[model samples]
Target: MPANLPAEAKAKWLRVMEARTPQEKLEALKDFLSSVPKHKGTAKLRAQIRHKIAVLRREIEERKRKRGKRGPKFFIRKSGMAQAVLVGLTNSGKSTLLKYLTNANPSIAERPFETKLPIPGMLQYGDLSIQLVEAPALIEGASKGAMWGLQVLTLAKNADVIILVIDLSYDPLYQLKVIVSELSDAGILLSPKKFEVRVERRRGCGITILGLDPMECKKLGNLLNDLGISDVIVKVSGEASAEDVVNAILGYQHKPALVLATKYDVSRDNFNKLEGACRELRLKAYPFSPQIPRENLKRELCRAIMKALNLILVYVKTPGSTPIPVTLNEGSIVLDLIEKVLGNRILGEVKYVKVWSNRFKFNPQKLGLKSPLGDGDLVEIAI
Candidate 1:
């Protein structure tokens, strides 16, 4: 018979997983195993926890051995763009969202966990293109590091922004709590006060939306107090027909957000219910039908996305080099890279090239010279 486990043991078990180093994790595991009373009720759980710890210890040893023989296990090269991750439960329209927003064509299925590997997509908003990465679904006990939960959490930690998608058809609040707990368990530390505001452009007008912004921090708490919302914010737009709203939010600066109600064609009342819920949460909700013709909606959404992101596309040319592709936001400096290459001492020696009438002229250099310049290239001015 297993013993009844105390609350302290469970808390200790959680803390053990939070250990940073392998040695610490081992120590935590040992402590937890020792602290847990062995009785009929808890014996089975203790065995399970013990098995997990043993597996973790073995994996750690293997990693250490490999590190001694080699260097690091994996190398992630940083691309020159801020990375945003789209996360949600399986079939929560994450893949669909990625497809509509970026060039990435991940498998969109009705099944769960369609995206096992991290899928990266380039989101072209106006002239700037941001990288959007979609991670796998997070399951229950994810906070406890169950079934690759730790891996997912690690990915989330590295992200500049985390876009958590949830199905409005289900309990949105419940889903939010699950994600928050998972993040907390993974040590991501998502504070409501730390939430930033994102401004999006919709229908040729700029719309400012509150995210986890400080101004809205209390709003979430208030909602919780009223039992109106759960731990997570659900946007009905994922199921809605308004792709523009979705694009606007994604391309929005400061990570602005709105709720999208999808599958409105199924039932009018469903859309209304979602809208009402959004109103209660003080969020904007739009009804959308996914079955609508693609051409009818894509352009508007793309435009909105581009506008919201404040993206700019610039062309660059370097001597004896193929045109390198680069996208930058408006008002960003191209001289930073040039300075790095030319060194600070020689900064004044190079002239800044100005773009006039959609044409850039090298200072004091004659125009109309036949040079192959492709789109999205950065050119340096050499006097």
Candidate 2:
């Protein structure tokens, strides 16, 4: 509704003008949402368009349901020990990287945006199979809802970690800028924060807080009550500020991420610049090429992902079955592993857990649910 709209906005408006159906209009509207500048004057218009988008989406879904088919779904289920998404600009060697790293074949071509959908593959690292998915390119203005941009970001949000594939042959910094900007606008934080905050609504809880000070809890509770959210449990880990808490309440994901600079052999000089810049951004950047030995590449990639995610692998033993590996965050407890592998019902029945680890003094240590677990720990839940 702003008078001085940009050319991009006008182009998107043209799409709206040409839209003949509700579905077409929905897509056009989404396009314009990206086109329109974010400012106080356009807030009302953006809100109205968002409302229309929601209604149209529902209608589309309802029609699909009537026909017994699925609607516009761009979701990929997580597989392997952990899920990591590889995202970057067009022709950034994402498909090529996936081909070399994982056990799935994705079309690699010279054209832009050749890979339309998200492709999933499994990376066999020693005894573990880590799922690595290649996501569609996230272009500039993606957060405002560029062409399938929201869907691309949805793929990123669903992943446990992110690997940004950048082309070393080009100005890798610029590619990183575009991708990082889009991710930031999508509310994805790359760097690991010292603290994490989570809130869950429990109707009768009256705002219980864990791992936080009593005084701060009262302050937070008062704020939540002011916002008509009094039945939520607020959980905090490590140190967090007021802004961090507010960002958490508004919804954000602090993804574990790294940058993989492809075509390193072609642009060896650029790789140093890219790595230096990434270091300044607190992001680790690695050089990759097809000529590198596969086993060494696989090993290095496995180690990098494990370090980036701060993960510890726990091998769970089941009777008459092979031990299953489970990836848990550093400092995860036995109870956390129990619920993940055995489900919630079994947690209450767990008498004690038997753990065998090289770090422990004894061969097998009998521990409780709250006992901390370590990497390569063999666990048996005796319920």
Candidate 3:
């Protein structure tokens, strides 16, 4: 009901109101609370902002309390492979990218938010396979736990590399800003120091994984700088092939990744413009059309995945009727673990698995597993 609010304050208020998630709304409220004038005419608006902040704060506290009782969550086991997360707005070709790269075959549709859960796939490079996790849409208010925003944040924080997929048809800069803002709100620090990596010699070869093309080299340099790599000199030697550049980037302790532009066939001009933009930003850009033959696209994606995440794949086989208890990285949700174990197997008779961790101490009497077998422990499986 307050009148005569400043334009800036009005904008902030509007953002708070339209915010998709509680965290975003909370941040907008804080801005409004600080920026809006508390004069006689604007008293009501000021009070409204304050009220919203209080409500958000309460909700956040409640969530924290609930999460606290649950204790620390499970994170993916860091196996020295660069973990890469494919992130973008809903339906921005992220799933398609995953499918092409790792043959993950996540549900791909023209509709938004088709990928509600995080899908992890591995791109095998000889003996190595990097883990690629496709995250859900990171809309505004993602920080304060809006629509699995917290889950997205958890996945990103655990990742060593992030592939931000943007629709070239839209304003690339705008999309970048949105992603940055969300990351910042989630308390992810972007510092130049994190970007610095010590370049090492491999097999007496001066490994430079930067693209050989002039435009690619320039774009790679810019992207490295944006990611906080300041001191390294990235030179594009026409002699170096795209594979060489990709290897160099992956081999570097601090690897800078390429921004893959999907739907390249839509418009050559748009692709060129995006490439120009990438060059301006000092980041490498690759044009890809998943609409092409699936096999070719899959190969391209596999190459990209290998470059993005320095992964080595090692397959372990377990032979037993008993369920092999896989100790996933701490902070892994039970749901994610279940998916990993089953892998497209329909959830039929086995509804769930009981996780025995330090945090979750099971009382033998409570679960009726108190009686010790001749061996270690006996668990009664319930369908």
Give the better candidate number (1 or 3) by TM-score.
1
Candidate 1 residue-wise lDDT at 115? 75
Q: Positional deviation of 237 in candidate 3, in angstroms?
A: 29
In TM-score terms, candidate 3 sits at 0.45
**Against the true structure, what is each candidate's TM-score?**
0.47, 0.67, 0.45
Q: What lDDT score goes with residue 347 in model 2? A: 70
CA error at residue 153 for candidate 1, angstroms: 1.3
The clash count for each model shown is 40, 0, 22
Q: Global lDDT of each model? A: 0.52, 0.79, 0.55
Candidate 2 per-residue lDDT over residues 1-383, each given as its tens digit: 23345656755755664577878988988998887777776676577667657656754664465367465456688877788999999899999989998888999999999988889999997876789999887788776677767778768877888999999998898998988888876778788777977766554666677877777766666554333344567789998654566557644568888899999889889988998889987899888999988788888888788878888888998544678888888899988998888888877787767889999989788888888999899998766
Residue-level lDDT of model 3, residues 1-383, one tens digit each, is 31555556645644554567778768877876787666776665556446557646865775676577765433445542457777677766888888886757899998878987778887654444567788888887776667777667667766777677776666665665676567655545332112222233233232244435667555554443222223333444445443344334432122344566666666445767767766764455676666677666545655555444433221212232554333233233434344455553544554434333333356332122222121112222334
Cα misplacement distance, residue 101 of candidate 1 (Å) = 4.1
Assess the local accuracy of residue 259 in candidate 2 as a C-alpha lDDT between 0 and 100: 90
Each prediction's RMSD over C-alphas, in Å, is: 14.5, 9.5, 19.4
Q: How far is candidate 1 from the true structure (C-alpha RMSD, Å)?
A: 14.5
By lDDT, rank the candidates, best first.
Answer: 2, 3, 1
